[model samples]
Structure formats: C-alpha cells, structure tokens
Target: MDEHISEAIGRPDLIRLDDGLLCLRFETMKVVSALAAVSHLLDTGVVRRGDTLVDSSSGIYAYALALACHRYGMRCHIVGSTTVDHTLRTQLDILGAHLEQMPPSSSLKLDQNRRVDRVREILRENPDYHWMRQYHDDVHYLGYEAVAERIHARTGGGSLTLVGGVGSGASTGALTHYLGKRSVDVRLVGVQPYGSVTFGSGHVADPEIIIAGIGSSIPFGNVRHDLYDVLHWLAFDAALAGSVDLLRRHAVFAGLSTGAAYLAARWERREEPGRTVLFVAADTGHRYVDTVFARHQEAARVQDLAPRPVRGTHELTLPWSRMSWDGSPAPEGALLRSAAAGAGPGDGRRASKCQRSRAAGEGATSM
Candidate 1:
C-alpha cells in the first residue's frame, strides 16, 4: 500500500489506445518529480522538514510541490504564474501552500520573467528558503527512474517511440534516460507550443495562448535538447482539434498537451509502422473544459490535419509543424541567447550568510 496520497496520485496508468499506440496518463504528473526531489534534498542535508521551499510555477507544479511538502512536512511558498486559476488557488490554500500569483500579463515572456524575478526576491528576503528550480535543476529527473522501470516491464524492451511535452525536460527526458539504460531503443518526440523558446519556436507567435505546462517563453536549462529525436510545434487551434478528436474517438479526456502529443504520436506511428508509440497525458481535461472542450464544435477533423514538414526551426510554419531533430544538441542560436540572458543552471540561487542557520527547526506538519 502507498504510504501517502502523493505516491498514489503520482502513479500513472498505461492505456493502449490502438494496435501500436499507447497513452501514459497521469492525474497529476509532476507529483512523482516533486516527491522524489524533496525527499532527496532532505536526505542529502540540503534542506530539512520545516524549511520553507519556494518556487515559481504555472499551475501543475504548484500543486505538485504543495503535495510534496504536505507529504514531507515542509512549508511551500509558490510564486505562481498568471495562468494559475481559481481551482488551483483553492487547492493550494487548502494544501497549506502560500501562493502569490502575478497579475495577468499580455505577454508570456513578461509573465514568466516576473515570476522568476519574484522567486529571486523571495530567496533574498528569506535566505533559508530553497528554490526548487524545476526548469533548471536536474534533481527533478530522479523520480522518473522507477516510472521508466514500470514502462520497461510492461513494454518488454521493444523498439518504442515516446512522445510528450518537453516541459521542464523531466517527464519525457528522464523516462527515456532511464529506459535507455535498460536497453530500450526509444525515440523521443517532443511536442511544443508555437511560442516556446525551448525548441527555437520563440520567433513565431501563436495568436492564441501557448498551452500551459508544456511550453515555456523563457529558456529552461534542464531541457536536454540532445534527448529529443523530433520536434512538433502546435498552435492552440491544432491542439484543440487533437483534444476534441481524442475525446470523440478514444474517450480519453486529457488536456491540450495530451491532444498535441496524440497528434504527434499518430504521425510517428504512421512513419514507423512496427514501433510502439506512447504519448504522455500529463493531466486530465477538467481544467480545459471551458477553454478547450467547450469549443469542440470548431475543432477540425484530426484525420484531415497534418503537420507541415520542416527542415529547420527557420522553416517552421503556422498551425502545426514537424521537424526531425535527430538527437541533436541545443541549437547554437538558443545557447547564445541563453548566455546573453544569463538564464541557465544556478540562476535561481541567492547566497546569504543565514543559509542553513536553523536546520534543526521543526517543519510544518503534513496535511
């Protein structure tokens, strides 16, 4: 039996959607990463039970971190993104995680930058607080080791193609990293929103919102660009079509990111007829009911939709675009931009004399 609700919620269900296509669905995906990261930090003496763990999150990671803190008797203080809705705010409040959400902004970059700046400010004020840099730190990848083991056991070490959002790089990157060690021939396909800087799509802006929890406007240090074999950029309308068709055809009610992955996975399956293709459904469709599912009537036919094949990010176009990355390293252009912006690993750290001065203090009791 699971000792905590975090474990239960972190466990994912592998559902076969077709002869060669599968869906790895999670109710709340990041819980696995958050739990393992917090436990590792505590065990390694980097933090204790009571230290207030602070981080910036859009929505899912806030809830995941809150649950992790609840499991480990830590206090969580989140600098939330503008996308954080009332439902998540209520959950965070009940979970005992203090949230200070940013005012809604017109630009994604501005919103993300504001949150990062806020986290730095919080760290300076509360020097004892540890910033869980989910975008930049690799500790978040540890939890997926066991998850990869489960996937290997079920899939029987065959040639597999894994498709999912490259958000924070922990989910698809960590899973493929561990599975590769077990001799699984896995091809990683990452799905991105049009405006995400992670995969050179920052130059193109989608009129609609960038799908939350999957893509980012700022550079994420942990995104191992070499781990990805192909890339797909989907606009909101394209993702909506995929999501609507997924519910209509397969009865799987998943979020917009899942819909985008579903579309990419189907294409990969067609390209590699013998390989088993599995896509990650990071969360359920409930949060997207109004923004996505409610507008199902306008959703295009998934059968009629196809990605515009591109040679490079420069060639990326419109509603949907696909490029064969071939396991290449991070683009030189992206690296230069990151260096100029100074947004890589160790960016979130704020040194202070009071660091670890109260390691023995008792932490907040778990909810």
Candidate 2:
C-alpha cells in the first residue's frame, strides 16, 4: 500500500519561536515511533495475522497505535485515561480500536496506575496478544533515531538543548542519547508536572494535577536519569498559562505538554544565551482546548476587575532544589515500590518482550 500520513510522520517543521528558541513541531513523532514498534511485531513473527495489539496510553500514543494498526491490519485495544474524551474516542472508533477508558482521576499517576493494571489483566488473559508496552519498552526508544538525525542536520552541529516532557523517555531520552552519540553538546532539560513520580518527585497518593502524556505516577523504564542535565516541575495553572500564552502570542495551538516545554525552553534560552534551545510541540491543542482554555473562560470577567496581565507568572524558573538532580541512582526505592506494586520486571511481561526485541535489534527490519 502506498502510504501518505505515516510517510510524513516524524518529519517536524522547525518553527523559530524567538531569536534563539525553536519549536520543533512533532505531533506525529510518536506515530513514527509507534509505527516502528508495530512493524517490529509484524515482521518478527512475534505477532501475526489476527493477533491483537494491546497498550495503555493517555491519548496520543493510543491514537498513534490506532493509526499503525489500521495500516497494518491488526486489532488494537487501548486502555485509556478519562482525558480520552469523545473526540479521541470518535477517531479511535473510526480506526477500529476498542478503548476502555478509566473514570476521571484527579491526577495522571492514578490514571496511569489504573490503566497499567488493566493492561496487565488483559495481557494475562490473552497471553498471545502483543502488548506494545509504550511506557516501559525500549523499542519505543529506537523509534526516535531519525528524529535525532534530523535535528542534528538542522542545527549543523551547533550546541543545542533539548527541552521536552520525559514521557516514556522515548522522545526526549532517545533524542538525547542519539544526538550525544554524534558528539554533539546536547543539554537535555526535562519538564514534568509538579506531581510526577519521575525525576525525584514522590508519588502523591492523589496529586493535585493530572498532566497526561508527560508526567507519570510510575517510574518509566525508558527514561534515563543520566541523559537529563536539568529539570523543571510546573503546576497545572502554570502550564495552563503557558498553553494560553502560546496560542495568544505564537498562534500555535499546542498541547499542555508543549506549553510546559515551551515555557521551560524559553526560560532556558534566557539562561543559556549562547545555545540554540529547541523544544517540542508534541500535538495540537484541539484536544486540550477545554482544560487549557474553555473551562477558564471566567478569567475574562476577572480580567476586567484586576485588568489582568497576559499570563499568570508562575514558576518560570525552578528553585535551586528542582534545578539539580539528586545524582542518586534510583528514585529512593523504585524497586521496592515496583515489587510491592506487583508489576514485575519492566512493569509487566509485555515490556520484557518489547525489551528483548529491542536488544536483538529487531526494530531495524527494513522495508
């Protein structure tokens, strides 16, 4: 079949946000990664005709897998968070994906925990079904090699900083590893919701924020702590302000994670004036219009009373504590937590399968 959209996946447009800041539009980057992972399953005979593809995602990865399964003729089941609303539901339905969504959780951690639990249950019942393990699998990391190559080519080896949410570690982690392999001075800055369990943030039994697709309640195996040089944690209102300001200023309607990264990257550019600071716009804001904009309509009325400024000045800069990583190996006791959580190896057996294939270099199966 002659492909169109998948062919365009991972090819990002470099948008000059400021004099030195750049926004790499990468809505389809995950699709490129997801396609590689899906193709790996099909070509390796690990999964074949009539086999189902199972994974847990908040929204974007689920949609990416849905697209891949549509093109490859495989059954897909997505265990989703409540943020997977009717808009995403309609798209997945069109792609023939069965979505089982969890109720509205106050935070991404709870949602992820529940979804991972559901995914494990499905894998147990249907052991033959190939679970994509988007969160814990190393194969997803392999999917971003081309992205790193493009960024390297785009910058022509000038010093650069990568700014993005450390979700699943596929995009940001893999990009840093690949770029660093070329001997490029890659300064990696990680952005996460204030309540994420990743990057030294203790898991809140119920975090106040639920920034999906970026922050995680659980430790992601693919996320390499050593790859990151700096980190920032943004609260819900802070990220929401950035998202709104991005649309207002740049007219680029991006997701919440993008805004968070954008805010981080903008600040980084000011701090590191000599480097070309590049950040990611993961997906469009069409999905985030409600939470990031619509629900906050009351702000207009309040704007008149206080004559409010453009963006609410939140944590534009991280405190000294948030800036420096502990330099410790693991997150206090991630192993003990994982064991008590009963999520086995890389969260589950499915992740183990993906890691094995990645180690064997099966992701490089050519066209």
Candidate 3:
C-alpha cells in the first residue's frame, strides 16, 4: 500500500538473472531521489508545498521531479536537454510541470551546457525558485538509504558486488555508502559512456550518442570518484549489444544504461565467482525501442564482447575499456576545474575535499 504513485514507481524489483547475478529493475529510478528531496525541502522549511522547484534534466529526472511535484502539491520547472523526447514532454505537460527543452544539438556537451545555461537564466528571472541541484546536493542520497536497507535485508549482508551507471551518483554511490555502514563489503563497479567526464573518459569521444542518463558531459558534483572500485567505459555499440543480450537472454528489457551495467555485471560476476553481483536497471526498454532494439541485428554478441583493460584514463580506448578505480580521487583534467570554479549554474561552491567529505558525512547521518 504505497501512499502515492511516486512511491509505487520508486520501488524496485530485485530479479535473479543468474547464479550470482541480480537485476534491480525500476520503472524510473530517479523518483526515489526526487520524492525524498522535495519532502525534505518542505520538512525543513526551505520550501513550501506550493513553491516551484527547478533543475536541468535529460529525461528520467524531469519525469521524476514532475511526479514529485504532483505528489507533494508543488510546482516543477525543468530545463530539459535535447534528449527529452515527445513521450516525456507529453507526460510533463499532463503532470503540470513546465518544460523548456534545449534546441537540437548533435553534441551532448552542447546540449548539457545549454540546459544548465537555461536553468541559470530561469533562476535569475525567478530568484525565489529552488534549484534541486540533483548532481551536487547530498540530499538526493537520503532516499537510497531505504533502498539499501531492502538490499541488505534480502541479500543477508555479506560481500556483494554492485554494478551500475555512475549517474549523478545518487543511485549506486548512495547504495554502497549505506550498505557499507551495515558492514556489507560492497564492491562498486561503475559503468560510464565514453565521453562522460565523471571518470575522465571525456578525452576519448564516443562517435555515437553518449548514453544520456548514465554519464554526463559536464562534471557532476555528487559523483564520488573514490566510491567506485572499478570503472567501465562502454560505447554505444557495446551498450547496444548488452541491452539486446539482456532481453534475449534474461527477458529483462531495460534501458541502455542497464544494458551497459548488465554487460559489466556479467563480466564481474564471471571474474569473481564468490561474490553476488547486482546491477541497477534504471528504466524500462520503451524509450530505447527505436534507437536500440530496432537495430538488434547489428549488436555484437554479448558473449563475444569484452572491455579492454586499461591501466589509466590515458589508456582508455574505443568501444569498451575498463580500469581499476579502487578508491581513487577525481582525475586531474576532468571537470574538477569547473567544479572548483563553480563554472555553471547551480554549482554554487567548489567541491573541495573538505566540502565533499562533509557532504558525505551529512548523507551518512540521514541513513
């Protein structure tokens, strides 16, 4: 008995895909974070029931925030990336959230920059509006604590390997953080798109589209680089193979990010036979039906595909690459500069070491 549709949608189903592999599937994952964030704002008097909240989103977060607003009796304004499709637009419209989509751009970097710029302009015009800052604020991590509890309870609190896209870091990072608090030896393997700066793969461009929700063109303040144990950078074709294989083999039709995570999880599970491996499927396959499933013929066999092991970001190559990121800090050239400089809208402060640690500490308290 969920109180709202958001609660129902946010709850994930843990499905066993193999002997040691599990899939945590969600209809739309960001709803977990969005609902908790808005409720916290209202609870703390930072925002009221009717105050408008704004942020830049590509797709999932836009719908999540809109639903959150609808549930909590608030208003949502989304500055959306060019990837926000007609389906999502229609949903936002019906949900009463305002959406301002960026003009079409082939470059994901440009699209992301435009969305952030638009958000800044909106904030200037409406100073009273609160920016959710999903990529930076640790408040988004609060909701995942309950999710972690579920995982721990189901899995019985042992050494487990968690694989998922290193998106804004709320999902995987928060899960690992809370699980570790309960003495679970959680090995976090982060999946990334080639052009994502989150883990310094921006130098190597993906010829195809950067997988929207899994990675980011700009630096995300919430991504805890040190939280990841290993990193895999998968290009569009590799992820397509993964998505196709996931559906064909396990009957789990999920988004591109899930495909990437599935591919990574399969490898990690094969490599470490002793540990239980679970990956996050952030959304369903409906959005990717045309872009991915339609071109299933071209996808490489998941059994035949593997990531090229790289010693460092400098060694990262084309279709797929993997590197050991065992508790490492952000790379030297990534958006650490922009984050420190507060280069864009909503990135109010430098994510200095002390500040990031303090944010993580505060998040732990919520758990």
Candidate 4:
C-alpha cells in the first residue's frame, strides 16, 4: 500500500485564534518523531533487519512508534500505560505492535516510571531490542526541524513566538532552537501543569489532571530552561476552559495541552500586539471526550473562556480570544523549586539525580 501515516505528520495546520495569534494545530502531528529517529538509526546502521524496536509511551508516542516500526518492517514492542484503552489496544494489535501495559498507577509520574521499568525488564529479556528513549533522546529533536523551517519560511523569519507544552523538550524546545538558528526571533512560551516539577512548579502530584503528554513530574533531560522566555503553569480547569473554547468558537477540536498553549498564545498576543504568535495542539479531541467535554460540571466552567486573575498563575487571559489582565511573580520563576528541599539555583541535588540516571546507562539524558 502506498498510504503511510508518516507521510502526513508535519507542517501542521495553522488557524487564526484571535486578532493576531494563530493555532499551529498538531493533534495529528504524530509519526514524525519515530520517522526521524528511525531514519537516522537506519542510515547509520545502528540496528538492522531482525532487530526489534522498543519504546515506552503514555499515548500518542506509542501509536507513532508502532506506525514507524510497521513502515520499516521492524518488530515493535510498546511499554504502555494503564490509560491505554480498548480502541487503541485494537489499533496496536492491527499494526502488529506488541504492547505490555503497566499496572494502574496513582499518578501520571508513577505510571510513567512503571512503564519505564517495564521497558527495562523487556530489554533485559531481549537485549537486542533497541530502546527508543523518546524522553531523553537528542535524535528526537531532528523531527521538528522541518516544522520550524516551514514556519520560518512562511513568516519570513520576522517577529514570532511559539507556545506549547514543554514535554520531553522535543517539540517546543527543538522548534525554538531550529527557528533561532535561522535568525528568527521565535520567543518560546513553555507550558506546564501547575503541579509538575518542570520550570519549578510545585511538586504536588495531581492524579486528577486529565491532561497527558505535557508537563513532567521529573526533570526532563532535554529541556533547556534558558531557551524558554516564559513559562505558564496551567491549571487543569484553565486548560479545559481553553479547550472547550477552541471547539466552540474555532471548531478546532484539540487536546488539553493545546488549550493551554492556545490560551497562553492569545494572552501573549494581547500583551504584545502586532506580533505573530503560534501554539501547538498536540492531539485531537477524541481522546479527551470522556474526561474533558463529557462531564456536565466541567462543561459549565467552560462557559467563561476569559482568563481571570489568580494568585499563582503564570499568566492570565480572557476567554480564548480576549485578555482581561495578566499576573506574574515579582521575581519571576528565577528560583524554581525542585523535588529536593529549597528553591533557587546553585544546587547539586538535581545534577546528582541526572548523574545517577546517566550512571544507569541512560545516555546522559534528563527525565
């Protein structure tokens, strides 16, 4: 068959959000990560025809890797989360990807760690299986260069800002670096849930946070904090409001992280008018139907799309299109608190954690 999933993964659709901002929808922006990484591995002969491809993913990445392995004629094994449902389960089976899901973990971080542990166990049993460390791998960054290049070419490298959830540091981080290398003023607005350890957000583990694929409870090895001009610790409710609004006004059904980015991009545009702001929608709304839009109480909250003043908000906005006001910590998040005690820089604690990960043969990657 000539049809391939990887063939339609990048140069995502761009739609107008507000006066000057646009939504760089990526709910369908899967497959590119696997395609890019697998291509590099194949070209360099890292693994050949009988080798199996293995990776751990909570959702979208799992499907992408499965599609990639199928295209390349490599056997694939996915260490997945309990969150994986029957629909996706059937899809994986159809694609000939073996999947082993972790037991139901309380929090997203625990689920992720459990999946990682499963991967380790699988690797031990089959040592030849190549682990596509999507979380910490630098090769994953290559996937978004074409995306960034396309945006740069379309915008003529003028004033632009890219906003998206900071997960694995792959999409947002790589895009920022790629555009910056082309001499474009691509300001990065990184998004994370309020409870994530990323960007020094509180370490409170939110099991109720329905949003997936963004914000890490652990330190991400690939995240370059300096590359982010600003960070938004989005609350689940706020992100939900943004998503509902996206569906209602724009008819662009996207996931929660997309809403967070969309809201942030709109606020950024309001603050600095006449600037081209773009945000990424990581996935379609189908995955979030039961959690996000199906609930009646939460649906009521979505009626008010405007962002209001909150005590600890990273930024503020009005609904999806308008901006009432914005707020920030006086000193900003200059002193981000880690899981270890105390806030601020000049600490060896996080470095020690990273080093320990490297000592375990994780290839010097964070997360």
| lDDT score of residue 59 within candidate 1 | 84
Which runs of model 3 end up more than 4 angstroms from their true locations? Answer: 335-367
97-159 in candidate 2: lDDT tens per residue? 999988888655566677777877887788877777776566776667778898888889889
Candidate 4 structure quality by residue, lDDT tens digits, 60-146: 888888878887888888877887888888999999999887788877667766766777777788888888877655677778888
TM-score of 4: 0.82
The order of the candidates by TM-score, greatest first, is 3, 1, 4, 2
| Candidate 3 TM-score to native | 0.92
Model 4 stretches with alpha carbons more than 4 Å out:
1-3, 205-207, 296-360, 363-367
**RMSD score of candidate 1 (Å):** 6.7
What TM-score, computed on C-alpha atoms, does each candidate reach? 0.91, 0.81, 0.92, 0.82
What is the Cα-based lDDT of residue 364 in candidate 1? 9
Number of clashing pairs, model 4?
9
Clashing pairs in 4: 27-282, 27-283, 221-366, 305-319, 306-318, 306-319, 307-317, 307-318, 307-319
Q: In terms of TM-score, which candidate is strongest? A: 3
lDDT of 4 at 306: 49
Judging by TM-score, tell me the better candidate of 2 and 3: 3
Off by over 4 Å in 1: 336-367
lDDT for 42 (candidate 2): 78
**Alpha-carbon local distance difference test for all models:** 0.83, 0.67, 0.83, 0.67
